[model samples]
Target: MGTTDVVLTDTSPYGSRMVTVEYEGASSVAYLRGAGGGIHGAVWLANHGQAPSSVDLDRLGRGQAPVMPRAHTRIPEGTPPFTSAELEVLWFEEGDGAALYRNGDLLAVIPGWADLERGMPGYARDAVGESPFAWSLEEALEGLAPRIAKARSYWEWRHGDGAWRSFQQFAMSHLDTRVGPPGRYWDIGGETLPTVGITERPLDEYTVLSTVGMSCQRMPTVEQYIDRPDAYARVELAVATRHEPAEAAQLFLWLARYPWHSITWLGHGHTARWYGDAAGFPLGRSYAGVLMLDTVPGLPDMSGFAFGGDEVRWLWLIPLTDHELQIAAERGHDSLGLSLPGRIP
Candidate 1:
């Protein structure tokens, strides 16, 4: 059966939301409530958090763009009303995009407005376009609701790890195992992986955390290369000085092409087998394959190594001496497939 996603209220200011969602297969924040949209600001947080929107009214008043600097986790104890003239939204439609007023006014929607359009979904709040932290640990629980809502099965619900977990706890205090997906993988390692169990997810939810790439799916701020991430455009513009973005983007693309190669399973079957093969091959054989295990104990076998494709090919074609295979076995698996480069849909 397919995994189920369950949705429930998650309310809390200082903790993770404990949403009861099902089908939390992986522990990446990619499964977290709004880790994709909230941390990344793709879907917008105005509709998620207590406050109506994330627009900086002050900036709007100044005639400057009201780019929100950061997402406010909580509604200030004493704040203005939900109604605000400065409220604006940005989103794409049919063949174009627009930055409309939150209520009904269409502010400005023009070509090349992906930045403003993204902010309409709430990604624009980072006035500066990127965050400096590896991750925005102080995320709002409410923003992640859509993620769990969409991912959980009819019988399950998912929760967040940091502030999200706390929110889930507030919603139902605790969860009913058979009723729906448990809120968080409490006490698990810092991962957002699935829980293991018939009535429960196999992996621990509590300990799981989101990575930059995974976080990128939800919020642009969560980056894999940058602990504190920046917007794609920002990084693209800053590539010369900080080439990490370009490099990371390349890695992301490479990963997309070889998804089965993800070391998410804690290094197991495919890992030992594949790496074993690669290691067995002649010294320098650039062989690659998917280590299908969730995560192998000896996963990430290519620690501190890059794909020396040309060199590996030359080494493999030359053939390994007996001592070489023996030495390779001692290291780890190294299964290589004839990686025919292709494009990802």
Candidate 2:
């Protein structure tokens, strides 16, 4: 609410293992990651449980280059190769233990998401790389063939709608033609990438992000139908978030506003802030980290990207029913989480 600095310990109170916090004026968020992780059912959101200092609004607005005094990962190496406008998915490629860079300049690299569905997140670019060097939507589609095929199989099994809603206008949106890098059908199986008939016109253009060395080429954004018709179909589920009553309420309000609604919130400084509806901002967050969905984002980060610090962003598909949503929220259950016993088995 206001600016005030406080230091709090969460080691025993929540019985958590590792914890971290980011303070913005009077607000501070914290959560556990080492043990159960942030299984709060909101993707990779932030929590200020530890301790944070309140700062003056104007001073905070000066837009300080976030100085994470003590961080876990390293920054990417080299000078940025392109502007934030040049490409889509491009950046360092190493592991969680390495650093992150933008156009080659060292940026922040927090602890890698330990819980990606099939990959542990090797060194990746800034989620959204520039254009030109980055793959065109067409090129990306080709590289993503295997991933898409795999995802389609799973989707077809669960949501066997004739229209293949699982892909859900994925290709059409590319037709918008206003978002990221242009196309070049270099390896297109059918049409030349350019003639792929894709466009980026309708997209806010600002709300797109890319993924490097991931299961796919990019992680896009948007917020819509909670999970989907059955709530059982989930393409992505936030296992948890890191926030307390106040912040959680704020987040909840944004989530339960019905469909086709929107809101405007801060972008955690990683990217610019863009206005989005509160009703079902697809990309969810927690104090542990923010799980940005390529398919949908609750509030598509202005830069069309977000980062999860302590929390690990796991990708999967689970359409949540209202009953299920409430149940998970009430029990601290993750919408698409892997049960410990199940994981072990």
Candidate 3:
């Protein structure tokens, strides 16, 4: 939580400086480099299972930039480009590896001690690149793709087109009217990219907007944290509203990357507060948050269906006022009953 200056700083041949900063009780090396008149830095956590090797210390001593000391990966080529905001580069203790994600979907994983240690200096020597941090999102994806593919063959749950069809059949089975586009028609920034889909349907009273692609990827760490993780790890969100379908769709965009972006899970009786000013919410100022549930009295139950061999849960999004949100937090979302109480209705 806090840092103390311990090891003296060493400068790189490239003019970057590496300093040992003690975080909590662990020593992490902070790499600071001058870029475009500003100094930017990244920390390599000490808990990554290996310390800087002698070659690293020797290179730093010789005023040469060491092979990248942090754990990282290269993803396969032809993989979709991830938006800068959605990309996550993580170092994991279990794999002794680094995992890359774009909007919660795993892109690649690279082993820390072997592949990165031996391969990175080759990258530096060839003038290819030093770190994912050093490149733009597109450039990073492009550069890392082949290297990651070569190091390890990667596969994800949502690997094929067949899974989408499987989900569509399950979803349409519960709906009163099966007429609607198969996938999302609009693009909104900050939403999950290439891995999630939204479909809008017009009904007699309210328009229904549902996320189709959410269940495709399993929520990370769900198995460790939740009971019956198989049933809960895969979830999709929906909203039924009298407002324009476009307006209701904004709510999905806000939440599309939430579970993985936050490194958590969502399930029945969960609540998420609006990210910004309540007034800025698509449903308007009165609704300050959302309460997720598997059932709503007047709506069809779209849950309990299997997709990609995993049970998918469809959670209805009920917008709530600050007072209602507080009540749900204290008493539980079940106390709110099955209904939409916001002005958007």
Candidate 4:
């Protein structure tokens, strides 16, 4: 059996436009109302069985990117516009493997270490008649300064950082060869990071929020936790920093690769498993106990340690060891005494 859903019907100065969609098993069609409400722009969803929602149809009609259902939730089909700070943060987290696009054109696919060693020097030489390693950081910066200046205006408006300064700082910090062996290719950093790679893709707050809710409900397994740590971390950071959840989920869907982890259902008598070494302490379960005076010379009477809470659950890892637990405790001090979810303090 099949079903037809009129996802959206809109009338504008141009004409009356309605998006009628149908889904049956692995087949779907989006029929557009053309001139005089005639059928046009019929597209097929050959690989996806999910029916298009009203929001998706509306976005398509409005010439905006539509969201598609993937795995356990829906995600944006195209790249969304990203601020300079967001781009910088993403690049910092992803390193050279960050995927960048502009105006639906693939701009730069930042090469990883192996790729750099094998092909970067030749590519740079062919592009500019010299090995990228030949140029010092200053020379690279000088060459890229003009491009940086041009892109700086957009970022300055988006983030209040001085024109090109933020980009310059990021380049200097991460591209420095002196920091490690990888500094040999600092020139590559100058070439790509300064350019505005993001397009004017709209990100809706509500959509992102809904996606985040879905992601939380579809929790990853331990194997998935290990494989897509960056994706998980990015989403967690986004939620922590209050970015739209849908955007984070979209990013995760775009970037995450599999051997997905098995789902560990949370219930009574069920152990929560995660990544890292198994420590004696339970992850995400808060504990209150006095720090002995022998361990710490001076401490407040009421001061106690809590292992983990709702806010810090993402920090908990698989096979959490004692030393790692201590380090996490030290780092996660701010999360102490925070109430767990569904529990009264």
Which has the greatest TM-score? 3
List model 3 lDDT by residue over 81-181, tens digit each. 22346545443311123445546764333322222223321111111234522222333556555535432332332345575566555565544343343
Query: What value does the lDDT take at residue 107 in candidate 4?
Result: 26
Per-structure clash totals for the candidates: 99, 91, 3, 13
Per-residue lDDT of candidate 4, residues 1-345 (tens digit)? 233344324331112233333343333333344336554333332224342442345544654323333321222132232222222211111221122223343222221221223433111110112222111223244543343343334234434556344433432333122122121111111222212111111222211111111111112232223553323322111111123323233222321121111112111111122332323122222422111111111111111211111111111112223443464456642223323221111
Q: How far out, in Å, is residue 16 in model 2?
A: 34
| Higher-lDDT candidate of 1 and 4 | 4
lDDT of 2 by residue, 258-296 (tens): 111111111111111113543433333211123223223
lDDT of 4 at 101: 29
Best-fitting candidate, scored by lDDT: 3
Worst 10 residues of 4 by lDDT: 291-300
Instruction: Report how far residue 13 has shifted in candidate 1, in Å.
Output: 18
By summed lDDT, which 10 consecutive residues of candidate 2 come out lowest?
188-197
Off by over 4 Å in 4: 1-234, 237-277, 280-345
Ranking by TM-score: 3, 1, 2, 4
Write candidate 1's Cα lDDT for 1-345 as tens digits: 223232222311112211111111210011112212222212122212132245555634653322223343222221222233444333221111222233553222221112322432322121223321111212422443332233232113223335334333432222232123432232221233211111121122111111111211121212323342222201000001011122212222222212112211111222222234455331223433222222223111111111101100000011233443444456643532222121010
Residue 200 CA error for candidate 3 (Å)? 0.7
